[model samples]
Target: MPSTVPDSLDGWWCDSSTEYAFVGFSYEVTACQSRSTLNSEFKDIRETFDGRYVRLYGACDRTGFYDDVIDAAWNNGLGVHALIWFGFEGGSEWKDRRDNLIDTLWNNPKAKFVTRAVQFGSEPLYDYVLDPSDLAGNIWEFKWNIEDLGIPVTISELAYGYQVRGGAQIVLDSIDVLDAHILPYFSQTASTGDAAWKDVNNDLNWFIDHAAGRKIWFSQNGWPSTHYSGVEPNSPDAVADVDNEERYYKLLESKCEFFKSVAGGGVGWFWHIYADWQEPGYGLYAESGKTKFDFKPRTEC
Candidate 1:
């Protein structure tokens, strides 16, 4: 793993659902829209938000949906954190899908320039889909296969999983980068705004202590702008509207700057998404493709 870390946090998690109406089995979420609509959304993300990189989940299927996503991102001048989806129940099928996706990316010329890294999977351990040892073994195998490409490989996990679960250390040691999802809304104790920052700070510190000097990346982080009925019942107020979303983003920027100063720039943060989908309130842009708020990062306190 390289000791150097990216100096700025300017990435987003993008998906093909907005256009393709694909079923995201892992989360049971679906986005039903047109390809043109999705393209326009990507354009808005690039031009309006100033996003430099995008993280995508899952491998390119036979339909080549993700290939189109990679194309759109590169054409819009965005790098990619390409992720491979792993479903624990179907080991053989999952391996085949993973291989095909990798082959598609490796063979594509655009991918050569836009791929920032290849993530093995997202939140497999946290979801209990794969035990840490099994996940670590799979990551190691994938890492070996992709090492020739000279791109870093990692697995994204919930920040506290490493400390709460027994086997995350092996998984952590296997990857080139440490990707953790830090969502204060999901904490056992409810929190919002500046109070949420404390939770995030504690999580970040936990990662720093266990990461063994590896670069730490926040694979997903964001506050939803609207409250969803029945979802997050325990932390209902954790969801924000336009105004509070701005507050959270600013707080996030400040925290990132602090982390950069302490970690010496070996950290990066990717907002949860570019636009809202089935999950409302997380998108920087609304479903109608309007900017939700001004989201400038604070370089200094």
Candidate 2:
């Protein structure tokens, strides 16, 4: 069958998430009140590169980062397709901040903020991670927040892992947008040349079959160019002898096909692209300023 990749992937993720997180949490993830990295990395890439969309979560305080990234993307022939913000603990604080942030972003003509916003970053797991009740509470709060925004809201990270049983039920009322968070293969399997790319493909199929009446996006999906714990490698280099370049291309091809056949058929979709991680080669560009393996994919045909 031919690939059914969405007519437009306009993928989105974060430079903040990648540069600052350490075993999943980075300084940038937590340090929302610091000086801006916006004018440099975020703005430069959004304007200079072919990057069409950029995702930002929380940081209502820095307002500058929000303005810079969106402004750069809008001014540079690109669009800030989504303005992703986070909700926490069913707290009124989160809702209050959500309103202020949305107002600030939308009010500024230079900011170019639209109703195209996402509610949670990784908040769905708030029950296990925070309060057991928070999982549902947060979702409800999100629905309210989205209704307030008068725009569609996406739950950016929906886990297939055990913590998210009844995953579809948990998010049904809270989100208009759903993304499958699938990360296949990592160090151990890839190092031994034993990893298969099938895991990611299977996860995509499982998500597609399960997510009905919901708009879907492979919100957090990709293979590490290298490897890490819990997340394995489906990289071409993992196989030593098979041409690495071809392997890389196949990986991208497969991902694009999955998005076409499965995700695009749903509601909306996005791919994760982190620009500044020097560790296991997870981005299209390395921190040292080189294209990781040269098989990078673009949004436009």
- Candidate with top TM-score is 1
RMSD of every candidate to native, in Å, equals 7.9, 9.2
What does candidate 1's lDDT look like per residue over 1-301, in tens digits?
1133233323322321111111011111134234565466556556665555566644444456556666666666666677777654546555776787678666775564567677777777766667788878888888777666667788877876666677478888888877778777766664565568777878888888877767677777767677776656356456457776677777776554365554423556777766665357777668896768876543223
Whole-model Cα lDDT per candidate?
0.63, 0.44
* Model 1 lDDT, full chain set: 0.63
For candidate 2, report its TM-score. Answer: 0.63
lDDT of 2 by residue, 1-301 (tens): 0122123223423222121111111112234433355434544454444444444433455545555545544444343434334444454455555566566554655442322445454544533443434545665665564453344565555455423654545555455655556555332334322244565556656655655644455444444454446644445446432234235435544444334344324222233444434224445456677655544344321
Model 2, C-alpha of 212: deviation from truth (Å): 1.9
lDDT of 2 at 240: 33
- In candidate 2, which residue ranges exceed 4 Å CA deviation? 1-49, 57-63, 81-100, 109-115, 130-133, 146-148, 161-163, 186-196, 227-249, 254-258, 263-271, 277-280, 295-301
lDDT of 1 at 206: 82
